[model samples]
Target: MAISASVSLVMTLAFLLASCGGMGTHRGTPLELTIAHINDHHSHLEALPDQIVRIGGVDTQVELGGFTRLASAFRSYEGRDNVLRLHAGDASTGTLYYTLFKGRADADMMNTICFDAMAVGNHEFDDGDAQLKSFIEQLHTGPCKTPVLSANVHPQRGTPLAPQNAEDYIQPYAIKNIRGIPVGIIGITIKRKTQDSSSPLPSTSFEDETSAAQRTIDQLKARGIRHIVLLTHQGYQADKAMATKLSDVDVIIGGDSHTLLGNFSKQRHLPKSAGPYPTRVANRDGKPVCVGQAWEFSKAMGEMNVSFNAEGDVTSCTGQASLIIGDRFKRKDAAGKWVAVDPATPQKIAAEAATDASLKMLAEDAIASNVLRSYSSQTEKMQKESIGEASQALCLVRTPGESFNASGEVAGCEEANQRAHGSDVTQLVAQSFLRTSLRADLALHNAGGVRIPVPAGAITLGQAFALMPFNNVLIELPVTGEQIIAVLEDAVSSYLDAGRSSGGGHPYAAGLRWHLDMSQPKGRRFSRLETKDRQSGTWASLDPARTYIVATHEFLARGQGGYASFKPIYDSGNYVNTHFLYTQAFVDYVRAHGKVQRPAPADYSHQAVTTQAGVVLH
Candidate 1:
């Protein structure tokens, strides 16, 4: 009996990697391989709102990054030979797509692209091993049969990932054939981060990253696979560091820090790149290792073309990370609102996109779009359910007195920033966190986490999701009042120095207040710090020696976004994972209150602000 085409396709890339041996090949056969990859899609299946990017030397707005657009981009490389389509990880747990449908929606969208392999990101364990197992099952239902790879992870017997003594649910590596050249792609998840921060099974354990990786590499080399690629979920910096520690690691595609790498000198409006695309570093043997990462939220895809000699050593690697965007154009109107531009604007933009190496203009792939449409309809129906109402328009501002969305999304937002208090929405979110966790004395929130302003009208589940878009859970940390002051200083000094996003690092809190003097040095920048007693509702000066429980999201608690003081405390095993979803906390708060309004002036986190230029807003 003859094998069908589908069966042949599956057989061509041998999945029986453990038992495979070397095959005869031409010694001098040079190869050019193109790797198409994405990371940290985080269930953002739909297109994001209008984003401002530099187009034609002007800031132009366009919709960016959807799975449908990614599907189209990946399909564009079909005609090319020796191509590998990969996803680094964190494909689930962010938007309503993951919350309502779980991993099924993410699986459906991923099946559209049919990735060759995917790494195991820490967020995959957010709901435990059973949910991840279910997701992997859905991913396997399609013809791709993409292998889930994580070298260091070991599931104990009877765990969901290792049920009934089965060990094939997640493999250490996968073998792929590129034009008769057998290559090994290994997966390495961040070890300690997953165990400490995420909800993995207690019995399941992860090995030290460097040791496990080297063991896997040696095994592949023994099987005569020389071209090695590591699909890792560790942060970009960690990936670069790990590259130097290992041998035979020719290329690394990574995720988890959401670090954007590549030069965007022409596209000045895009977020700054952390490093050059394909950042080259020397391996242990002084050989080269190329590292690349696409930005978060499906905004970009990385294409790295590696040229190899007969020995399978990478001679050169080059490519660009292109921002996937739609042709539809929008620009700020006279009223400062984002509105559709003239029809000719898109054509002109598309013309420029043709020449721009960093931008790729594309429309949603029809098949992927159709697949998303069914789930999107369900999402829409559920999101429309009313939760509560806002008594007034709560302006969205990152920093007090900074003109962000003043006349645009929220009318009269200009007046909202006239005072020293920062974002009303952010403070409200902090209050929700504190309220949800009764053990905490204060709630701290990053301004960037809260996405949109609250209009003075009905608030729906969709609006709540829009408010807190990340999959961050609430955690309580016990720290001295002194550490609280220092953490706030760290947050302010991070962006105050320059060349950073100020709004995202700005801190907002409930049951706490502070007077900030931006003109002062880092430690001296904050003064008049006070804490409110929950029972008496009386404010008193924060005692630097006193221990206090602080409520914050997992991101900040992990020392991200310049909250350096929180990490050590969290690592000390003195912290509590409340396991309360942030968005759900807001929903619960709204349901309990029936309506929401801005906190009183005395309760605002930012009691006063003295700008760097000596202007005070009070």
Candidate 2:
């Protein structure tokens, strides 16, 4: 009986690792490797609408980072030898590009640059194993094949990723014969976070990332592969720790935290960098090990130059991560349509009035031309298709609350209008749910769930989806009025204790109103709680003991992101999905009420402070 091909592939790699004891023959040459990497791209195929950059000390709007600039960066390294391009993880989710086309649009773009090797991101499992398997196949449809890797992943028996199809795509490590010297690239992904956050099946399992890296590094070294690079999605801080944990790993190219590295002080107006490029950490043996992360959303590309001694130990590491941006392109308004750059600005890259014309000229190469263009052409048309209209701009505002301080006394709010009020976006989404679900007494939604503002204009399907990108379903659950109050308290109290950045965990809701007093104790801040009277459309005090059916998204119902108060409700099995996509519900609700108008400006909450001492959020 002959052994299977899958068996052979697995056994051969294992045998190569298992049987080897000593260093193999060739000492060859002092190797130089240039690795270009990006992670958490989130299917941002083009320059994102919200990317802001400072030009000539002027807060200028420009196209900053897209596939075009990344393509140019890769092309710049053409004549260099032993060069490899890597994407750490998360090549999915976030935009209409992924929503309409799914991973196909992302796969088409990946094939454009054809990364040498990529780690499996948690978002890759958003559609489950079958989709990830399909994406792997699609990614290889190019002149050269790009290997996908994830060393910590172990799919249980009877799963799609079980031995049957797994061997064809995912690999533990890839050995590249660079400059006659073997360089091993190992992949590691976030373990528990992947299981908790995404849609991976129950049978699939993840090992500890540090432990997995050590095992893989040992195997690679056993086979006499010297220069090992750990390509990971475990985030920046963990990458720093892994340097001390893994002895043989010379460099860690990382992702998942979306951490920006390198100096950005020169580039004012950009978000501050997390640390220096290739943030150096000492290994267990006290040897220098370098780590780098390109900022997320393909806004930047990581460039690292590493030199190794003849013995395979790294001698020196250098190079900085750079932002990818364009000098010329159209700008977008808050509502996210392609609009011309401001005419009043002193400097304009292109003098012509930006028209509703082809942006296909931005496509600089074959990948953008043959692949991205086709998808762009269709989606662009769909983006312009009118869904409905809004009467006025529903601005996404974030204002620090009066009493919310790092010391945990004040319960601050993230957003406000003329009054220290809550966000309109959150309130609008909550209201839409109530309109669609008639039985609900209250509607609640997270402020972050709505990514963008709804500009007062013709709303398009593109804009609607952008505002709500998560695939959360509308869900309704039964809870006492007391529980609802506790939820609101928990939303603010937890963030205040942690001094959370963007700590605006304050929830917004419709069919309800409440007053928040910063001077009061944490749990006692909310007062004058009221619910809408369905009969008269007037406010009525909420009775603490009375039960009410509340509408919220599946994300909230699942008790995720500091919503553990809802976990008991989730465990009660009383909650049920309304079988409507939350984002689509907004569209349906808006269409049902022709010409959607901003809800009347009314204070949902009030804030007051007694202390004269200045409070600043840590």
Write one digit per residue (lDDT tens) for candidate 2, span 1-618: 256888989888677655653236445468888888999888888775544454433344556678866776677677766898999999987778888877888888877787889999987887777777778877887765788899988777567766465455678888777666778899998875566456677777888999999999999877778788999987787788778976878999998877878876645555467799878888887877889999877678888899888777788889777766555545556886656666664234332212211011132555565677888888898778787887866655432343211111111222233234545556777889888888888888776577566666788888888778778898899989889888887776655544433434557788777766544556886778888866678878888899988898887787754566887998888887898899988988777777876577542432321211233222
How far residue 283's Cα lies from its native spot in candidate 1, in Å, is 1.2
Q: Which regions of candidate 1 fall more than 4 Å away from where they truly are?
A: 1-20, 24-26, 332-339, 343-345, 384-426, 435-460, 466-509, 513-529, 534-537, 542-582, 588-618
| Cα lDDT tens digits for candidate 1, 163-204 | 876455889999888888887899999886676446688798
Best by TM-score: 2
Q: What is the lDDT of residue 601 in candidate 1?
A: 92
